[model samples]
Target: SQKIEQNSEALNIQEGKTATLTCNYTNYSPAYLQWYRQDPGRGPVFLLLIRENEKEKRKERLKVTFDTTLKQSLFHITASQPADSATYLCALFSGGYQKVTFGIGTKLQVIP
Candidate 1:
């Protein structure tokens, strides 16, 4: 069985700093790891994604890493702002597997 777990239930960071979030999996590695931001009463929005073969990926102020060996993925947001606060989720998709697994999500709060 494959499962995804966020490092923490909540993460607090000061604005203007980098906020790092962790997502760990067990049993099997996913072919792709996707990051999403979800706000209260709103559906999750896609942030960034990384393929199993890619070590790292970046989009604007967001960056993501996929490490199959550790069965983990990391998501980072640079120059964090209060508006960046949201519950972040990690989704896993396998190449031959039809099922998709999603993390419970970690709530990030950027304080001024």
Candidate 2:
């Protein structure tokens, strides 16, 4: 069985700093990896996606890296602000009818 894991605890950081989050998986090779941001009582909003062959991807202040060999992905937010605080999730897809696996998510809190 395939499994995805993220930090189970909340991460706290000062405003205007960079925040780095990690995602790890095992037992399967995913063709596409996606990251999302979820706020309390709301569904997740997509942030970024990286293909298995891609080494790194970026959009504005956000960046994502995928390492198929390690079955891991890293999400980064530069110059993060308090508004950036939310639960970040990582989803893995193998490109079939199989269900997408999502990590439990890691909560982030940015202090001013």
Candidate 3:
């Protein structure tokens, strides 16, 4: 069976520190990987998308690395702030037409 796991516990951190999160999976031939940010009771907003052929991709203040060999991906937020607190999710596009299955989101809490 295919599965994805992120830290179920909330991450508590001080402002200005880097927040790192992990996504691990097994028994999946994922077509693409995506990351999203979600606030309380809100739908996930897409942040980054990486196809299986890509190794890494980044945006302002955000970086994502995909390692197909290890069946894992790493998401990092640099210079984290209290406003950056939110749940982060990793999803895999599987099956035909890119059906997405999401990992349980990881909550991040940043202190001022």
What do the candidate models score in CA lDDT, each in turn? 0.90, 0.93, 0.92
Highest-lDDT candidate? 2
Ranking by lDDT: 2, 3, 1
Can you write out model 1's per-residue Cα lDDT over 77-112, one digit (the tens) per residue?
999999999999999988665777789999999999
Candidate 3 yields a Cα-based lDDT of 0.92
Please report, as a residue range, the 10-residue window in candidate 1 with the lowest summed lDDT: 93-102
Which consecutive 10 residues in model 2 have the weakest lDDT in total?
A: 92-101
Model 3 lDDT per residue over 18-68, tens place: 999999999998888999999998999999998888988999999999899
Point out where model 3 deviates above 4 Å: none
Write the residue-wise lDDT of candidate 2 on 1-112 in tens digits.
7789899899999999999999999997888899999999999999999998999999999999999888889999999999999999999998573778899999999999
Residue 41's lDDT in candidate 2: 97
Of 1 and 2, the candidate ahead on TM-score is 2
